[model samples]
Target: MLEMRKDLFADERDDNLNEVGKGSQRQDMPGHVTARTRFFDDHAFDGLLHLKVVRSPHAHARIRSIDIAAAARAPGVKRVLRGADVPVNKNTLLSLINFGKDDEPTLAVSKVCYKGEPVVAIIADTEAQAHAARKLVRVEYEPLKPVFDVEEALKPGAPVVNETYPGNYFEYHERFDHQKLRFGDVDAAFARADQVVEARYQMSPIEHAPTETNGTIAAPEHNDRYVVHSCAQGLFFSLGTTAKILNLESNRLHFIGGTVGGGFGGKVDSLTEPLAVLGAMLTGRPVRYVLDREEEMLTGSPRGAERIYVKDGVMRDGRIVARHIRSYFDAGAYTRLSSYAAIKCTAHIPGPYSIPNVSSDVYVAYTNRCPSTAMRGFGVTAVDFAIEVHMDRVAEAVNMDPMELRILNAYRDGDMKAHRRVAKNTALIECVQVAAEKAGWPLSDTARRQTSVASGGAGERGQIPATVIDQRGQIGRPDTRTGGPTQTLPAGTTRIALSKEPVMEGARDGRAAPTQVPRYEPAPRHEPARAQPPAYAPQPAPPAPSYQPASPPPAPPAPAPSPAHTQHGAVRFSSVFGTRRR
Candidate 1:
C-alpha cells in the first residue's frame, strides 16, 4: 500500500521532455510514474477470465443419488459434470514420489471424505450462473458417524472412516525409532540429584491466510492441447496431477502463472485444477474455479494441534542428566501430509539443550476433521514452547540463573542434534548470551519478589547486603539493569491485599487466577529525538500534448501458410484440458 513518488508521474510524463526543464526536475508533483509501471502495464493479464466454484457441506456422508435436472436447465449453464462423467483413464497425477498411490479424485465418486468436498461442478457462461445452478442440483445424502476427535477415532471400538486403513491411525513410520539419551547414569544421577521437574503443555493449531485463494482456469482447444492458468505454489505437482486425472501427456499441458498473493506453504498442493479442467473438457468451453474465504479456511491446510509432556532430571550442580518428551498430534481427515509433520516434531525434542539421557516419542493420530497441512515454522514451535518452560522450572529448582543454565547446555555449531547429525549453523549459545545481556541477567529484586503475600506482616525485609534500588526503583546490583529498558510503574503505586482464604471454600472449581506482577516507580523524562522529513518542491506544467495521426490498416489480407508447411494448421486448445487427439 505504500506508494513511491515515481509511480505517480509515469502515466502523463512525456518521454521527450528536456532534462533541464522544471517539469522534468519536479519530483514532488502528485503525478509521476516509475519504470516498473510501464513494464507491468505492458505485461498485464489482458484476456484472462476468472472462475468460482460451489462446495458441499457434509462432514461425512454418501451420495445416494444426484439430480442435475434443474442445474442443466439453468440459463448460461454450459455443463453439469459429476464423478461418473470422468473420462476412462488409467492415469492419475499421483506417483510414488510423494504419495504411496494416487488416491485423490477430481470429483467425489461414491463417498465424500470430509466436509466441503467438491462433488459436482456446473460450468456456465458466467461464474454467477454456475454458482446459482450449483445450488439447484439436488444431492441426496446418507450421513454417517463422524469421527471429530483424534482420541475417539483411535479407539478400537470406534467406527472406521476408511475401511482400507482399518482403524483411523492413517499411516505410521514404525521403522523410525526414537533416540534415547543415556548420559552419566539415570539411577546414580537421580540419587545424587537435588531436584526433579516435570510439566505438560498444550498448543493450538494455526492457519495460513494467503491473500489469493487457490484457483485455476482451463480451456480445451483443437489438436488435443490445453492451457491452464494456476495460482499453485508447486506447478510440477499440479501439472502431473492434472495430466494424470485427464489422461493427458504432461508435455501437452501448457501452464501459466499469475502474480501470487502469498503461499505460506498452504498453496503447495494441487487442489482445484483437475475439476476446472474436467469442466472445460465436458463443456468445450473455458471453466474457472476459485474458492471463497470460508472455503479457504475449511478446505485449506491448517497447522496441526498437539499435546506434549516433558520430564526432566537435574543435579545439585545445575546440570541436566536425563529427560523424556511424549508428543501426540491431531492429523485430521486424510493422512495427506501429517507423517512429515510428526517426524519434524520428533526430531527436535531436545531443542538447544544438552542432556546425557534423553527419550522421546511422537504419535500422529487421525481424526474426521479437515486434514492438517503445512504452516510457517512447521511443528517446531509447539515443542519449543513446552521445552523452554521446562527449562525455566529446572533453573528455579536449582536456584541458578536461567540464562546461565542455558549457556552451559546450549549446543554449538559442531554439537550433534538428537538425529545424530552435527549442527552446522547452531547459534543458540550466542543468541542466548546476546539476549541475556540485552535483558540484564540477574536482578536482586527477583529474590525478594514474592509470588504471593501471606496473611502476616512481611518477613524481616529480606534484602541482600550489597544491592540497592536503582533509579527505576528495581533492586539490583550495579550494571544489572543496564541490559535494556528498566521496568517503570506510575507514581503513588501500592500493592492490593486479599484474604488468605480462597473466595470459595470446599469448591472444586478448576480455574487458576491470573498471574500479577509487582509494580516499580517511574523513571525521569527521557524523550527520544525524532528525525526530520525530506524536502520537496513543486513541478512545472507540461506543454500541450502532440496528437499523432491515425495509421490506416493494410488493404490486402495476409497470405496463408503453404500446405506442405501447415502440419495441421493453427488449431489451439485451452491449456487446462488434458490433451487433444491429432
Candidate 2:
C-alpha cells in the first residue's frame, strides 16, 4: 500500500523549539474556515463587465469566416474581439530559455487547431449576457483530421497540427523531436553488462481539480496602465510573461495576487490574465473573467499525457551500467509549459542513479487538444513512476531484494551524473534505510553498511524517504503517477545476466564499504616475483618513457542484440526519460 511519508518533509519544521513537534495553527486557516479568504471573484467594483470567449468546436479546422457583427450588436454587448484584435497575438512561453519560439497565438487566427481555441470574445454588462452574446458569434469551419498519438504525429504522412512548425514536433537546437542528455559511452557499457532489461510506461492526463478554479479581474487606470488581480501561482512570472505578451512594459501592469486557494503549478501559465487585461484596455472599463466549473473541467490545462520506454544494462547484482530512454511528451494543440515539462521529464531519467552510460531523447510533440501547463512536478513525476517500476523489474530479474538493489547503485557524494556533473549531499542510501526502518522491515548487514556519503556518520543519514505502494491494493487520490491502469504495465518478456562481484575497499572506521562498480575489468596479477636485479643497475636501466603517446588498445567485443522495445501504446497527452552510467 502507498504510505503517507512524514519523513518526506522533515526539513519543514518551524524554528521555535516548542513548536517542533507540537501542532501549530496554520496562519490561513482562520480566514479560510470562516469563508473570509478573498479570491479574485470576491472583489467587486462598479461597471464590472464579464468577458466570455467563443471556443472552437472542432478538434482541427480552418476558419472560413468568423461573423462577430451579430455578437457586437447582441443585447448588453459592448464589444467583441477576435484574433485580429490582439496587438501581439503570437507568444512563446520558453523564449527566455531559448526553446521553440512563438507557437501559441492569443486567439485562433486563420485556423483553430484544437477544439477549445478561442474564436471570438464577448464583453457585456453581465456574466449571463456575455455568455448569451458569445453564442451569437458564428464561426464557419472546414474540419481537418488531427493526430493524437505522439509517435503517429512524427510519422511522415501524419496531419500537422501547426502548419508553421513544418511538422508535428517542437524543434530544439536545430533538431526536431529530440532533447539529448549524453554522458558516458552507452554502447561500451552495454557490451560489458551481463543482461539488459526493458519496459514501457504510459500515463493519461489528470486535471489539477483545485478548490478554486482560475479567475481574473483587470481594471484600467490613467496613463494607459492596468491593474490585474489574478490567482496565478507565481506573481512575477505571470506579470512579466503577460506584460511582454501584451506589448506593454512590466511597470504598466500592477498585479495583485497573494491568495491562491490551491495551485500545484497549475496556475503558473499566464492564460486568462493577458486577455482579461486586454479586455479592460479595449473597453476602457473593468473586465472580470471567471471560469465556471464546467469551463474549468473541459478547457483548463491539465498535466500532459506521457509515454516513456526505458532499457537498462546491468550485471547480475542489479547494478545498472547503461540505460537508454526515449520519451515523447504530447504537448497538445499548443506549446505552453509543456516544453519545460519535457525538459524536466528528460532531466529525471536514470533517476538519482550513478550509472556510467546514458542516452535520452525527450520530445514535446504537438497534438490537437487543450495546451498543457505545469502540474505538481509535471515531467519528473511521470518519469519517476517509470524508472522506479523499471528498477523493481531489474531487481526481480536478478533475484535480489528491490531495496538492496537500490542501495547497490544508489548515488553517493561525488558521484558523476549523466549531465557530466558530480553530485553532492547524496541521500538515496539513507533514504532506503529510513524507509525500511519505518516499515519495520529488517535489512541485511551489507545494506546497513551503505551510506549516503560513503563515509561514517553517527546519527541517521539525512532523510530522503522511499515510499512503497504495494501493487495489489488501490492507491486513492486522482494521481495518475502513484496509481493508474497504465502505470503497472509489464515488459512481457526479457533476458538477463550478471557478472561476479568485484573487490571492495575497507571503510575508514574498519567496516566493509560497498564495492565500487568499475566499467572495465582489472588486469591479471603478475605471477612470479621479479628476479633481484643488481641493486644499482636495475632502476637506471629502465628506458626513458617515449615522448609520443602510446597507441590506444583494441576495443572490447559487442553485446548480442536484445529484444526490441516500444513505448506503451498511448497517453492522453507528453513523455521523456534520461540515462546515466556510473
Candidate 3:
C-alpha cells in the first residue's frame, strides 16, 4: 500500500479531496530522472570575472594598514577592491523594526573582529587567478585579546567585540541589558508550598553547514541598473538590503533566485551580493563570487550559542506554580539577528506547559568568535531542548510521569496564558492523548476523565456542555486517586497531580484505544462533484473542477484574534481566499 493510504480501513468514508490518501507524483522527479537540472555554475557568459576575498586570520585585530598594490600588479587580476572603493558601507537589515546596533560592516575598514571577516576583494579573469591574487593582498593587523565566552564578555573588564555595545551586551534605549517578561506574583508562587527544581542548559555556536556553499553572480546593466543572481531565500529582503548596502534605489536592482540548495534562515543574511554587483559595475563585466567549503564554514552565519537557566517552583503533585528563566545568546563579533534571537529564546522558554507565574530575562551578549546569524530554529531550538530536559527533571522532582505532568498543565482553548492572550484552537491535550495511546502508556482514571471533559469541543459538533470546560477550559476532573484528588492535588488542601493523565471521554472503557477523530465534512452540495485522485495517477484524464453555476468558493474564515505575544514580523494575509484583497 502507498504510505499515504496506509491508514485506510475496510469501511472509511470518502472526503472531497480523494488525493489526500493516494500516492502522488513529484513534479521534480522527471528532472532528476532525465538529469537536466541546472545550478548557478551551469550559466556561462563572456568577460566573466571570478572574485576571491582576503579575510582576517585573527579573531580580533585592528587593521593597521592594507596594501592592494601587489595584488593589483598580479597577472590576470583586474581590480583589488578595498572598503573605500564601495560607495555605501552599512547594514540594511531590519531597520524598519528598529533593530538596535547596526554594526555589521560590509568590508572590514580599520579593524577585523572575527576570523574570516572579509577584508579585501580580489577580482580576476580566472578563478585560479583570483585565488592567486587574493593571497597577494597584504594586510597588517594588531591582535587584540578575544573574548570568546558570553559570561566573560558581559564582565566589565572583558574586551568588547564592537564599540556599539559598552559592556559586550546589546542594550535597548535606557541601557536595559535584557528583555523582561513577568506575569503574576512569581516570588509569592515560589514562597508558597512547593518544590523548586533548577537546571542550566548551554551550547556552543553552530554553523548552517549547507551542501552548496554560498555563491552569487552579479551583472550590472546600463544606467546603474543590475541583475543579480543570488541564493538568498527572501527575495524582497535580499533586494531591499542589497539596495541599501549599495545605496541605490530599489528599482536599480533586480534580484533573481527561486531554487536554493538549502537555506534554513542562514541565507537571509545579505552578505556578498551587493559587493559582487558593485564589482561588476566597476569593471563592467559579469562577476561570480563563490565561497569554497572553507570560507562558507568559517564566515557563514550560524545559529548563535546559548545558555539557559530554568527554575521552576512546582507543588509536590506536579503543578508548576512559577517559572523563572534566564537565557543568554552569544552573537559572536556582530549582532546579526542575535538580539532578535534573544527575544525568541525568552519567548520559547518554559515551553508549552501551562504554569501560574513566569518571569524571564533573555540577554544578547557579544563575543570574539564568528558572528552568529539566524539558522534553523535560530533562538528557539536550543531553548526547547533545554526546556524538555528541564521538564523531565521536573517530573523526576515530583516523582510523576512526564506525560501525566503535561496532561495536568496542557493549555486549552480558553485558558489564559502567562502572556495576556487566551489560548484558542489548542490541541495540545488531544495530541498528547493520541501519542500516549499509540505508545500504550498506562492511563489512570483521572487521565481518562480529563481527556473526555477536555474533548467536549464547541463549534459545529453541537453544544456538549459549556460547563464540561470550566471558565479556564483546562481538563479538570473529580478525584479518581482519592475520593477527592491525588496527592499532587494539594499542599494545604488540593492541587492537580502532574503524574495523573488529564480528565476525559464522553464514554470509553478502562483500556486505552487510539481512534482517529472524524475529519470535518462540508455540508452536502446539490451538484455533481469531480472525482479527484492522485495528481500523477493516469486515470483517462481527470475531469474539471465541479463548481456549480453561481456558486462561490468556501467563505474565508474570520481573522483569528491576535495573541498576547507581540506581533513581530508576522505576515498576516487579510486576503485569505480573497476575503478582502487589500
Best by lDDT: 2
Q: Please give the lDDT score at residue 440 for candidate 1.
A: 74
As a TM-score, model 3 comes out at 0.74
**RMSD of every prediction:** 29.1, 19.4, 19.6
Q: Cα RMSD for candidate 1?
A: 29.1
Off by more than 4 A, model 1: 1-54, 86-103, 173-196, 221-223, 397-399, 442-582
lDDT of each: 0.54, 0.68, 0.66
How accurate locally is residue 394 in candidate 2, as Cα lDDT from 0 to 100?
A: 94
Better of 1 and 2 by TM-score: 2
The residue-by-residue lDDT of candidate 2 on 382-441, one tens digit each, is 988989999999999898889999998787776655554466667898889989988988
* Candidate 2 Cα misplacement greater than 4 A, ranges: 1-27, 96-98, 455-582
Residue 245 in model 2: lDDT: 59
The TM-score obtained by model 2 is 0.74
For candidate 2, the per-residue lDDT at 313 reads 94
Give the better candidate number (2 or 3) by lDDT. Answer: 2
